[model samples]
Target: MEKMKLKLLYADLQSDIRVIEKELETALDSSSHYLKDASLHLLKAGGKRIRPVFVLLGAKFGQYNIDDMKNVAVPLELIHMASLVHDDVIDDAELRRGRPTVKSQWNNRVAMYAGDFIFARALEYMTNIQNEKAHQILSKTMVEIVQGEIIQIEDKMHLNQSIRDYFRRIKRKTALLISSSCQLGAVAAGADDSVAHHLKKFGYYVGMSFQIIDDVLDLTATDKQLGKPAGSDLLQGNITLPVLLAKNDSAIRPYIEKALSGDMKEDERQVFLKKMRSSNAINEAYHISNLYLQKALKEIEELPANSVKKSLKDIALYMGKRKF
Candidate 1:
């Protein structure tokens, strides 16, 4: 399981991660039963906890201090959770991690309110660290992520969009936050500027690889693996690297065009997915993701040759080969 893999990768930080898990649960205590339940639902569903892992790892660059580092780790995860709640509403997603999404259980409005409340909690947690630089970095990242969401909405159904556009969007959407986690974590623990920069760059490369592989999995993985349809991204008009590459084939172009036009029927969607799974697009996407993995390794190579570097390097290798 991915959870087991993460634990193995972070074997040394097990106690710190457990502390973070407990903190996540306690952070949601609220007077409103509805808000409390909605937030708790998402928390209990379980996730890879990748952001928090990065935050903790970044802290290792400086003197490892769970107390100060947690202030950064908790909110990085809270921001990610808040984004997922809002994303479910925007995507009309019914399930997340094999359970009902907040929007599905309650409604869109409730999901929005829940997301806002969690974000507020993140800000409150952030304020606890009096570092103005950390606050500014996080604030800018929040704005960029929102802009990425808006661009995704606007670019959806536009199959001809440049590959550059797709890369930029994913960078803002996924990579920025992860990069911030590394940077902010280092800053929180008083890492030197050079160390923080390397960690931030490392996070960006790994984050890009992670999301690209996720997009690839969306096309190739089973419904059970994804906890949703395999072609959910295409069904939702979110063109990823696989879709873009597959669209160039004369044999599959029509099906892909139909998907882009928002008219893919059930059978067509299945056929499209099948053809895509067999196509070279998956291979091409993997090659690109491998590039990112290599870049990530290169960035972390500048850090001290220690267990922290070893774990980060292992995680990059794992991202390239991950199934879910």
Candidate 2:
């Protein structure tokens, strides 16, 4: 299966990932039982832990010290976890990775508090890193993520938004953190500036491809696969790459408008989902995603040949081809 293949690519990092996992458990510890429970709930739901993987891999390109790398890896994953908790609140999402979200399990206020608590823990861990450049990169990434989310809110349901608008939103919303993971890991391990720059670019391209493939899967995959209703993004009025490309067809425009109008029937939504799956829009979106993947590979090609570089390349390929 695709999941197993991706896991195989990073199999060498199993021990390092375990260390990061334990650190995450320790990091989420809190005196407030409520905050502790809420944060723990999200953490237990599990994820690809891709940010931490990128961090470990990036570190391999430099001095390759697990102790030095964990500082960067732990905080980045924490930031991502905190963002997911808050995003569920914003999306009013009930399920994530097939489990009830923090907000759904508790409530929105509890979720927000939990998110803030986790973010604080992230900063606490980040302080372990003395590198000023690492701090600067992470701080700016955090700000960009917030700005991206705000822009996503502002652009919601507005079909007139340009393709550039979509790209810019995703760059900050998703890509920057992954990019920072690579750069910060390299910086933490004292990699050369040129090497760090290439890894950062590699992560950026891979992240972009990952998000686009996600958007395509939103319409093409089943609810069970997504852990939420199919077409959930459309239902929530968030226009993604596939939808933006699909809207070019006059036949699809009215359906998109109806969906965006927030009055679509369940049956009609199903029809729209089907139409999108069969449309050229999906292919176009995949094409764009492949282009990004190629760029990611190109970035990897610039790095000195090593097992780390090979793993990074395999990750990029998996991102382009993953079904879930």
Candidate 3:
């Protein structure tokens, strides 16, 4: 019943995602050959499109104008894409969703220029809306998001960090952009302040849950499913929730410490990953994410009941249950 229920929620947004894909290509159309090609490479690679869909769905609760709503949706996706390009460079990530990342396909200089270019383009595109609140919300989110990345870098390899620190970092790194997505969508469509606030909270909670699940899958899911090695986060020295939780287990402590403290040979890395999978840590982390999903659903339920609201609720559930 739970699995069937989540499928139905995702079904609601499938068509909307198709519409957004077309709009995104149009948005990436640019005169500069290098920028256009680079941006298109990333755009065409595709994503869950969760942020733009949230923006569009939140808009429907108010005025329901696709044209006016698209102004916000496109830039929201562009902002997200811009961040991804930069993130790949910072993480030195070679792949995303099974394809070579921008930095991997091109070079770091191109990735940086491409990210900056798309960010400028996002601002240019969004200016059509003429709403000061939307700008303020998105702009502030962008700044905080960068700060969060900086904090993550600073905290990396420092395995002694607390759970509160992990939550705070993920909130800034992952949740803020998602929260802004919902907020900008509502404000662009002229929804009242209350609806925007609820959607913002909903996005924040779901974003946290979504990222926590992603971290879990980075260990539990197969390499093919993750498009990277399992336990890549730990290998990269970014302490995630499951790692934090498992480190508390006396039996699990050595594996966690060994993974964090040194250059792991292939066999050692596999042993550490196996230990994490066997521990209760992954289950405990999923429980925490489920709590956030429920909180997100509670916010969605507060909105007027409609197919869109139902779909958003379903997406929240889907994030909790996604396999990889």
| lDDT of the candidates, in the order given | 0.89, 0.90, 0.85
Alpha-carbon TM-score of each model against the true structure: 0.97, 0.98, 0.93
State the weakest 10-residue window (summed lDDT) of model 1: 303-312
- Residue 230's lDDT within candidate 2 is 87
Evaluate model 1: give its lDDT: 0.89
lDDT of 1 by residue, 1-324 (tens): 877986798898899998888888878878899999997788888887888889999888887889888888999999999999999999999998789999999999999999999999888888889899889999999999999999999999889988889899899999999889988888888889999999999999988998899999998998898889788888788989898887779888899778767788988988888898899999999999999989999999898655788888887788777988
User: 85-150, model 2: which lDDT tens digit per residue?
Assistant: 999999998888899888998899999999998899999999999988889999999999999999
| Alpha-carbon runs more than 4 Å astray in model 3 | 1-16
Count clashing pairs, candidate 3: 0
Candidate 1 lDDT for residue 152: 95
Count of backbone clashes for each model? 0, 0, 0
